[model samples]
Target: MKIEKRWIISFLIISAAAIAGLFWPEAVETPEILSQFGKTEDIVPADVAWLLTASCLVLLMTPGLSFFYGGMVGKKNVISTMLQSFICLGVVTLLWVIVGFSLAFGDPIGFHIDGRFYSVVGNPFSFAFMDHVGVLPHLKMASTIPFMLFALFQMKFAIITPAIITGSFAERVRFISYLFFICLFTLLIYAPLCHSVWHPNGILGTYFGVKDFAGGTVVHMSAGFAALAGVLVLGKRKNSSHIPTNIPFVLLGTGMLWFGWFGFNAGSALAANGTAAMAFATTTTASAAAMLTWIFFERLNGRKVSALGACVGAVVGLVAITPAAGYVTVPQSIFFGFITAIVSNLVLNAKAMKKIDDTLDVFACHGVGGIMGMILTAIFAQGENASLLHGGWNVFAHHMMALLLVSAFTFFGSIILFRITNAIIPLRVSEASEQLGLDISQHDESLDPNRHVPMTILDLAK
Candidate 1:
């Protein structure tokens, strides 16, 4: 078999870059930058080690998501579904290195209005092409690890955010359109949101004092709401039949995601200290609690508890506790998990009753769960001056305002993006393609050799 041209080109490019990095070093400007910042502020070895480890862990989530999503779609669409998530590893990584990271973490560019610092986004030029992002600590972001590692860690989050939205439309989407939409969404939606919540001079954190420990607001909330916008724009999958093609695949994916999440939540602390320890503990406790709660809810609703339900509930728990991980105790995390799991289950049921085609219930699980987590984070926050329970309603009010802003921005912004992407390349495949399945229609690949491809949905309807 001959290697594909694209694969050969990719291999050569990566080989060249790796060799250059190893030998020249200055080609990437890493060594010179380190020398310029010689003897700069304290850098802890443990923190560096942990952060590097965490970044690797977070990078595993995309493929894990692939299996999780692929198993849910029919066999004909399985490859296409999985590829949607897997492709992000390449698309978003390049985008992040070139511009996405700078747009998120660079110095602010907005002007002051009425004595309030209103920052719209970071300056792309600040770290453009990875300039000024090297071995030295960024100090403001994470003090121990190389600044580049922080950007890489955050890139994993950026990559996975749009991947989450793919579940909303799944098999119906045109692959080219999906690609364009993710790139646009990363820059317009994910980057700006990341700057707003995580950047020191961001509008939400600097002016409104909102606390998002690890992307409950930026990652899950934005993706969830954006997913809501997606389903609305794409409408429903034609000839829709929701069934799991591989329960075992789903189980495997869930295992990988859960394993990776320790790094996702705990790694956000950016240190190997008490905060990281607490985040790790809470992450595990919340996931466990949510999984059990979801099964209990299923039983109460007169349905048999299932592995899929357990997987979804556990993911919901992870989403909910993300914001509260560094801020709340393990017990509060358990509460967060239980509450979000129950609420997501109810919302999923409601969506089914209302006949909304959310595909895999992205909105119900991530959107609703994230909002619940954000609210609970405000209430159960641990610091004496941070939490509504301990301090006052001010923190709670800030979180409430932040939630509204995020929800509106992601929903409306995503609608505009969807329309724009749809205009450039039609969002959905033709009726014939839909009937043929994306594996054969778009990719010309299929899992089953003997499976016949139908001519059209009209024929199936007849």
Candidate 2:
């Protein structure tokens, strides 16, 4: 069989880049920057240890997400769905190391407003090929841990965001085309959002005062809106209805995600301190509350409480609480969990949402949950981060503005990326390929051994 020229070209490009990377010079840190934070001796052992553990935990979440999504798709599509998530561990990592990390955490690249420099994105050259990213603490970012560790932790978040979008168009998406879309989404969308919200001098954080303790806006919201755009572009699966391949996998995935989220939320503190402990407590409290609220809410709606409902609710709580985990009290987290579950459930059941054919309810569970999280964070934040209830109208107003900005950027930006990917290669598989199932049609693999038997042979035997 002849190999496609595109595949050969892609191989050559990757090979050239890898070889060039080997010759890239090690970045030198200036004495002024090093003294601004602390010397390498100031790096706390506990902070480094905690951050290292947290980084591992966050990395585990992607595989957990794979299992979580894999069990929800039809058996014929399970491997394809899981692979879509798993592949990010490889693809996004390389992208992040090369330039994605710089675009997210490098020096400010936006214009000055009222004499304050508000960065829209990071300069790609500032940290290209991990330049200036070393074991030394960053002056502005994380001072307690190595700068490289911070980048590594954030890379996991970047990897998982695009993986989350795969669920929206699962089963029908062409794997190669989906790969291209993720590359675009991560570079163009996820990196910029990360720069805007999480970077110290970012536009949303410094200029707008948006308080995303973790990544409610950067990760979940972006994934949710992008997923919505994908559903619109891919259209519905030929047969949209199917029994889940494995409920056990969903439960397992949920458990893993919950366990890892302690790191996802608490680790944002970059220290093993009181803030991290509070974030850990709030994370679990919200998830438990959401789990119970979800099942009971379903019962009230005249639907039986199900394992699936419980899992979805728990995850929604996690999403909702993420932004406020360190900012809110335990009681506030419970409220966050309860209200977010109710709202996301309602959105999931909305007749209008039903028409969109978001295959796995990604927009409803993640997108709506993230939106609720941001809204609630704006209302309930306390202390120096006071919000509406605390008499900070300006904070509330800016959050609303930031919300609109993020929604438009992630949604419309994703649509354009989808179109570009489709132009390069079709986003949806052919109808025949869809009927045959993506696992077999795309990967030439299947869960069932008998799947290899030709239909004609089975018909002849029958």
Candidate 3:
């Protein structure tokens, strides 16, 4: 037979098998609630309440990240690190509503406006957000708000993503450059990538049918790699001995973030139903498993597990199970948590081997954790054609490939963006700023007075 004929035959056979699987009856199945009209009430008030709550929980993560990053840097840079998240929360909120949403979720342009430039993958403006049509909450998906509210939740994501980058350059980056990149990164990088991943018509959703339940690939991996990119561009911090500036601060941030994880995971369900309940359970389970695993490993080194280790372990577990939470069983959640903590620990410790200095260990915690979650998702997933354990080996290879591809794309794009930013503006600050601290040099405010000041919407907004 001709080679072309052989290829065609193989393709047809695979297509037939997938179709067969698609149409196959489940041995044990829940009653299907298929809907054609997509009941509007699917976005019920309760679900809306849940979504709004989840959105707030997710927002809490930024300050959590800020504290996490701030504690890792030297005292001089502590306030600056925290401010990154605060500023991003304020800025990205406005950016997303105005343009990020439109670019990310807008209808594809007709190439007629200002001659295709208007649509060049979402207005090429370095600062402008993608075109946003409006908030759209789908009844079938269980969102209670308009599409705009959903977009706002996602904007928090965009805000936090670039904020993660600050950790890599903590104690060393120029405040102005940090601001510049947040806007650039959100507008040019995050918007398009989010569109590609979440937009129904994007290539990943329409063609590949990729499933990212709650930002294993989109938020965690993307931000982690961007941290790596920034680290590559801006070298390590000056001092060598002092690892963390304040363990207490780190613990504080960790607590806030843990509280927020509920929203991040359960809210993805976009409803106040069984699925959200499942996510809530899984989120806690995975975090505990990861924390235990971390402490266990620390004890092995003839050392008691410190507060930092505990928080780090919990974060790893949280990231690892995020993608799998809604679909996998409880057992899988525990397993993923254990494995992610151990793996991230190893990667984090091996940093001395490389010249790259990921200041906050973003790659170790978020990047590796996302990969672990994605891989385990293939094993634990259930339902139609789920991979082994859930769907089996047949689906495993594809999911693994997807993880690597996502990581590579994020790493390369971030590298390019970082290099460009570095070339145009200094990425790091002078020795003077390094010694004085970012709070005073960058924002002229101090976290010292954080509580004394009245709590405005701005304060909680982060």
Q: Which candidate leads in TM-score?
A: 2
Query: What would the per-residue lDDT of candidate 3 be over residues 275-372, giving only the tens digit for each residue?
Result: 88888888889999999999999899677879989989998999998887898778778988998999998898894624576767788898888888
Q: Cα deviation in Å at residue 116, candidate 1?
A: 4.8
Please give, for residues 93-191, the per-residue lDDT of candidate 1 as tens digits.
877877799899877877696886778698986676677877778767866777877888899999999999988888889887898899899999999
Alpha-carbon TM-score of each model against the true structure: 0.90, 0.96, 0.80
| Consecutive 10-residue window with the lowest summed lDDT within model 1 | 453-462
For all candidates in order, the CA lDDT equals: 0.86, 0.91, 0.72
Candidate number with greatest lDDT: 2
RMSD of 3: 15.3
Q: Which runs of model 3 end up more than 4 angstroms from their true locations?
A: 1-43, 108-144, 351-354, 392-394, 444-462
Q: Stretches of candidate 2 above 4 Å error?
A: 28-37, 453-462
